[model samples]
Target chain A: MTIKQIERLRKGAITLLMLAISILFLLPFLWMLSASFKIEADVFTYPIQWIPAKWHIIENYKEVWIGKFPFYKYYWNTVKVTVLTTVTSAFVSALAAYGFSKINFAASKYLFIIVLATYMIPHQAILVPQFILYRQIGFFDSHLGLILLSSFSVLGTFMLRQFFMGVHNEYIESAKIDGAGHWRIFWQIAFPLVRPAVATYAILRFIWTWNDYQNPLIFLRTDKLYTIQLAMQKFTTINGEFYSLIMAAAVSAILPLLIVFIIGQKSVIEGIALGGVKG
Target chain B: MQKLETAAEAPKAKHISKRSSLQKKETIAGLLFVGPMLIGVTVLTFIPIIATFLLSLADWNFIAGFKDIKWVGFDNYERLLQDDGFMKSLKNNAYFLLTVPIYLAISMLLAILIDKHVYMKSYFKVAYFMPYISSIVAVAIVWQVLFHPSAGPVNQLLISFGIDNPPKWIADPKYALPSLMMISIWISIGFNLIVYIAGLQSIPKDLYEAADIDGANAWHKFKSITFPQLSSTSFFLLVTGIISTFKIFDLIAILTKGGPISSTSMLVWHLYDTAFVNLKIGYASSMAVILFACVMLITVLQWLGQKKWVNY
Candidate 1:
């Protein structure tokens, strides 16, 4: 074979190999998706039926979505908390990033270092005292408390500051020279330049909040206010024997995240790329 | 007198006042912008940390209210050494650290393979990254079903291959931690893979050309060029990955609840149980202090260690 032909053949073989690996990697999810459409009796059938002979998709999903402790309530709660948290975190982080990167304040260096230091202390270390403090302050067992817990992130501020630094000094300087206040320059010139970075942080914050089981698990006590993760756990426990229903609920819980991933795949890849080079 | 002074010092005084006012505006704006985060971090994180430390030295049942708190000094820390459950969890967390290097190696290999030769990179990236972004509750529940002892796909495949008694993964005490580790590896490899691919792409290609000109083989090129060039990314992944393993709670909570004889119990899960389930706030705070200390120690060690091997 010619050298070009040999190289082409090798690449083709690797592609085929990766295709096989992808299938293997995705088997569990594909199984979960397949099982959710199967009847209870067929869920564990021998020889592992990859497809349901008779589809029970509507019935299974309906039971999960509208049953006692309906999932829609939890979904609504999750959406509210995740959306509010993301918006607040992104804006607050961006504002802070702009301040630290662009504004020449005397205490900015020390303040930024302090913020970075806080990221080192894991949230798990403070849960005990936070629980007590929240209880004492009457913020316990509320969605508002849960939202406030993660709305201000040191990591978010730090990540956004890196991008804001890439915005040139000339833009802010010209805006200042135009008799614009710091606020006007921030809103018009600085923030727009780093909007993509802010959006990236917002997207990450959304995913983190949506998938958060720890905060809601601890802070929110009312069954009526449980988020999707909490609700999914409760549903699974109550219906442990019904794998079909559990599979359906599991699929419903992650469907939105999958949709988000699909729509924001470009930004998500960019976020990881940015994170890759961080020291 | 005012008119005479205005005429004499108008330009120089006006410039000084304008510059100071602008500096004042900038400082005010900076404070206003950073105020929310600063206050939130202080009240929410810093105060709580201090409270955790003070509470660790005192015995206080959260239900009993403030006046009942009893200061016991180093007693709680002393008890940690003798507590079997705490010891097991400590050991388990150390064991979980094994997943970091394992995933890092696997991801590095996959990253190299796909970065150079693959078609449809986006499809593969998304497919692999799916598990990383999916809700851990969903991921855990799905894996729970997948690891079912008798009827699950995994054991079914094992049976087909003539293994008489496949291990009961989550249920079996001996296999539970390993099973959790396997799931963790699966969930995390995609993230590591994505990051590694980004690092691989950033490597300068002329180094490879030089190596090829010198008659270097693939392994030699990889060891000298690819590995060293990618060391910083590797170190970043290593530190973040190890830190995350310390935070493994959702999977254990869903799958084992640190059960099967506390075989899969981890530090965070144990702290959660002690604080929330048992309401031993003081004891849990002591554990939290230890947890904080360990993370600080690991991070400091890694920071110092990076100077030797992690290339900037």
Candidate 2:
């Protein structure tokens, strides 16, 4: 055989291996998706019902969505908190990034160093005082407080600043020569240039906020105020015996994230690429 | 207005004053732009951390309010040394660090294979990355069903393989933390793989070409060229991955809730349980401080250790 044929054969074997591994990696999620459509007795069937024989899809979903402990409220709560937190975090981080990177000032270096250092202090380490502080400030048990907890991210600021630093000084200078003020230059010239980086950060922030279980678990007391994560936990405990309903709840909780990922995967991959190269 | 005034003034004086004025404007703008984050960090992070330290020194139930804060000198720390739960949690967190190297190795191998030989790279990337992006609550719940003692698919597969008695994962105390670690490794390999693949792509082709010219095989080239070039990415993933292990709360909260026997209880979960569930604010604060110290120590050690191996 030619060397090219041998190479092709090797590639074919490796591709098949990767396909098998990927299927194994996806099996749990596929099972979850499949189980959501199955009747209760069919869920635990051996050999695994890769596809449901008797579909209870509508009934299962309806039970999760409109039954006791309805998911729509949690969904709405999660969407509100995730959107607000992402926008606030992305904008705040971008503004800080631009300040640190583009607008030179005496305290820029020191202030940025301070912010970077704070990123090392784990959030878990500070939750105690934050809880007390929130209680004192009347922010405890409130979604507004939950939003504020993650809105000003040191990591986000630091990540975005790396991208902002890539914005050439010449552009900002030329804009300055055109009589554009700092704010005007930032909004028009600097920000637009780094908009893709900001979008990447925003998508990440959205995912983080959406998946956040700890904050909602800690801060939210009212059932009405619970985020999707909290709701998922609650639903599972209440429906522990009902596998089909639990699977439906799990799917409902994860479906939005899947949608977000599908739409924004290009940005997500770029973000990861940037992170890799930054190292 | 400043530019007009500077134009009308003496040339040398105007140049100096204009420079200072521009500097002043820039400083003001910089401060304004950074104001929200600066305040937010100060109010939310800076104050809370300092308060965490201070609160750790005093015994106070949050429900009892400010009037009840009684200063206890080193008592919480002393008690922490004797607390079995805290000790167990500390041990579990250290054990959980095993997952970092576990996933890193698997991801590095997968990354190499996929980068050079696989078809539909993005298809595999997305499939693996899905779990990383999925809510831990949902992931935990799904795994709960999969890990069911008898009827679960995992054990069912094991049964078919002729192991009649597969370990009861997540339900058995001995297997709970290990099960959590397994889930963690599964969730994180994709992110690590994505990062590793990117690192692999960035490796210069000339080095490989030079190695090929020198009659170097794949393993030799990988060892001398690829691995060293990817060291920085590895370091990055290592630090982030270890830090994330310390923050493994969601899975524990969902799957084990610190377990049938506190076997899966890590520092964060113990801290949460102490502070929220038991309402031992000061006790939990001490745990938090220990958590802070441990994270700081590990990070510093990694930083000091990196100079020996990390290329960048």
Candidate 3:
């Protein structure tokens, strides 16, 4: 065979391999989408239906959204908590990062280390006491409690601190020369410069809060206050036999994140990558 | 605004005083800036941690409040040594950690393949990474449907291949933990792939060119150049993965509920069940302490061990 023919053969093999792996990775998502639209009996039919023969799209989605349990309530609860948590976390962490990086005060280094040391404390280890404290402080059984618990993250503070540290001290000095207060400096100069980093952490915080189950499970007791994850758990347990309904609910639960991934694809990859390598 | 005029009107030596006051103002501003976090970390994290440790020492049904608490000293810790539930959960965590190596291999392989001047790079990346960003609850539900006993696609396929019987998976005692591990592996490989791709991209091209000039084969190039360069990323993944695997709760909660005779239970699951369901506050706190200890010990050991070979 000619050299060109051999090269073409190698390329063909690689392309085929790539396609196979991509399809394999995408199979679960495909199954979820296809199964959501399939009829109850057709949902699990053999040969793995790539496409549903009998589309039950309206019926399945309608039952999930406004049926007996009203899944959209949980969806709205999640949206409320997610938005509040992400905004609060990003803002709080940014302030803390600015303080830790730029300001020099008594025991600043030790205090920062002490904050980071909390990362070593397992979430469950703190849960027992936090649960008690929540009861005492009137934070139990409400979205407010879940929101408070989710809003403060040590990892987000640490991640954003790295970006803040990259900002030159000369800017702080020049701003001071202009009689700009520290708050002004933080609001105007440092934040905008690291907006991408802040945005990265914010997007991640949004996803984490939206997907968080443990906090909602432990802190929330009211059926009306449940996040989508908590609701999904209850829904699946109660409706295990209804594959069509469960898959439709799964599709609804994942739709937001899928849209998020599509829109912020590059930033999400970069955020996790940066977060990983830094660790 | 008037402060500047007053400073100018005063002695020139007072210039130093103005600057000093500004520094003082900054100190207060710094405290004020970090005040919310300080209060948060203390109330939610720092105090809870200390409180958890103290609570572990006492016997309390958690109904009568702190006033009715009884100190049991080391009794809870003693019970952990004898608890079969605790031991089984620990073993299950070890089994779950088995996913780490499989994840590393599959993610690494895909990274190498896609790294080789592949076309439609972003398209391939999005497809592979879709699962990592997906909510675990949704993933579990779909997998539950797929793994259904009689009518599910997975069992149906196995039957068509002429196997008389397949494991009940997620419901069977022997297959429960392993089944969860499989779902974990499926959900996790996307993250590993993204991290590995980033690691591969950071490796310089000249390393490959230098290998080519020496007539080195792909295997040789990979061993010498690729492996060392990616070692740091792999080490990071290893330590973090170990820490995270110790805290595996969401999947167990959604998929198995630490059930079918507690086959899929991990430390977090056991702790949750103990504290919330059974109301064994003291006992569960002890378990949480152990969980924290294991995570810390593994992290410290990894940090110290990385001194051996993780080249920056």
Candidate 4:
């Protein structure tokens, strides 16, 4: 074969190999989507039917929505926590980033390193202590407590600080010369420049807070306060089988996140790539 | 008259200079900006880490409050050393550590393959990344269904091929940890792949051109050029991957709850169970400290080792 033919053959072989591997990655999700529509009994049927013989989409949706599980309530709880956490954390971190990156201060470098080091500590390492402190303060089981814990993000501070540092000093200097105070310079000059990074952090924080299971499981005991992840866990009972119902519940739990991700996926990917490259 | 005027102006200039000192004002503003985060970390993070150490020395259950505490000193650590559950968790964590490197290698290989093959690149990337985007709880549930022993698809496929018995996946003690590892690998591949692809793209084109002029074969070129350049990225993935795998709690919680005879129980899961279910806060705090030490040690080791391989 000619060199051109050899190159073509190599490319073709690779595409085929990639297609096979991609299918493996996608198989579970595709199975889940198919199984959600299968009849409860047929779900466990042999040979793992790629397509359900009978469609139970409406029934599954109804049961998952209103039957035994209060999935809607769980979804609402997740939404509330995620939104509150993401917005508040992003805003606070931006202000803090501005302070760290722009304003000259004694001990700023050492203090910023301290904040970054906090991120390195595994979150679970402090769980017991935080729980104790929260119980003492009477913040235990309160949505406000969960919101506060989620919103206090050192990673967001570090990421936004990097972005803020990238903002040209000329704008800030010009703003400062115009008699604008530090806050004004931050808000008017720095904030607009790092909007992409802000949005990126917000999306990431939202997904993380929404999907968080351990914190909610530990703090919130009431069924009314349960987030989607916690609610999904409640689907299985001891000595009981409800595979279809659980699958339906799982689907419902992931739907909102999937929607949010698909909407902001382009920016999210870019943000993640930027983060990796910059680091 | 000129000398007198100069002397008077000097005092005026000094006064203005003192008044215009922006450094002090800027410092105060900087502190004010970072004040909330500083206070938050001190109260919520730094204090708690120190508190964890102290709490590990006592025997205070939340039900009994602070008054019921007993200072046992190294007793909790001694108990942990002797505890079978703790040993099992440590063993399980080691198993996890072993499995993660294999997954990272597979992910890196796939990433390099995708990078080399230009056609349908974005499509393949998205497909592989779909699992990463899905919620772990959701993914775990889906896997549980797929791994069902009797009527599940996996067993059925095996039976069709003339095999009668199939191992219970999450339910089987022997297979439970492996099943969790498999799911973790699937979930993490996309993330590692993305990083690897970024690493691949960042490699300078001149290196490849030089290899081409040298009449280097693909394997030779990749070995000499690609692998050396991607070393830093690999180091990053290795450190982060090991750290993450050691903290494997969510999947275990959702799937097995460290069940089938504590086979899948990892350090974090054990910690959660002790603190929450048994309410042995002090004992659990000790486990957390050990976990912290292990992770810190691994990270420090990796940081030191990176000097040998990491170019930048």
lDDT of 3 by residue, B172-264 (tens): 899988899888888777788889989998999998999999999989988999989999988888787778788889889988889999989
Ranking by TM-score: 1, 2, 4, 3
Fraction of native Cα contacts reproduced by each candidate: 0.76, 0.86, 0.69, 0.70
lDDT, model 3? 0.86
Tens digit of lDDT per residue, candidate 2, span A145-261?
Answer: 999999998888988899889989999899889899989888898889889888888888899899999899888899999998999899988887898999899899889989999
Identify the superior model by lDDT, candidate 1 or candidate 3. Answer: 1
**For this target, which candidate reaches the highest DockQ against the unseen true structure?**
2
Candidate 4 local Cα displacement, residue A98, angstroms: 1.1
Q: lDDT per model, in order?
A: 0.89, 0.89, 0.86, 0.85
Q: On residues A165-268, what C-alpha lDDT tens digit does candidate 3 reach at each position?
A: 99999999999889998899999999998999988888888878888888998999999999888898888878867888888888898889888878887788
Q: Can you write out model 1's per-residue Cα lDDT over A81-133, one digit (the tens) per residue?
A: 99999998888888888889989988899999988898889899999888888
Candidate 4 lDDT over A133-171, as tens digits, reads: 999999889898898886768878888999999988889
Enumerate the candidates' DockQ scores in order: 0.73, 0.74, 0.64, 0.67
Better of 1 and 3 by DockQ: 1
lDDT of 4 by residue, B1-312 (tens): 999999999999988877567777888899989988888888889999999999999897879988999899989999999999999999999989876688778877898888887578888777877776777888888888788877678778888988877888888998988888888888888888888888888999999999899999989977898888989988888888888877889899988989989999999999999999999999999999998998899888987898987874
Provide the RMSD of all predictions against the true structure, rounded to 1 decimal: 2.3, 3.3, 3.9, 2.4
The alpha-carbon lDDT assigned to residue B61 of candidate 3 equals 82
Find the 10 residues in a row with the least total lDDT in model 2 chain B. B5-14
Residue B164's C-alpha lDDT in candidate 2?
Answer: 85
TM-score of each: 0.97, 0.96, 0.95, 0.95
lDDT of 2 by residue, B19-104 (tens): 99989999999999999999999999999999889889989888887899899978999999999999999999999999999999
DockQ of 4: 0.67
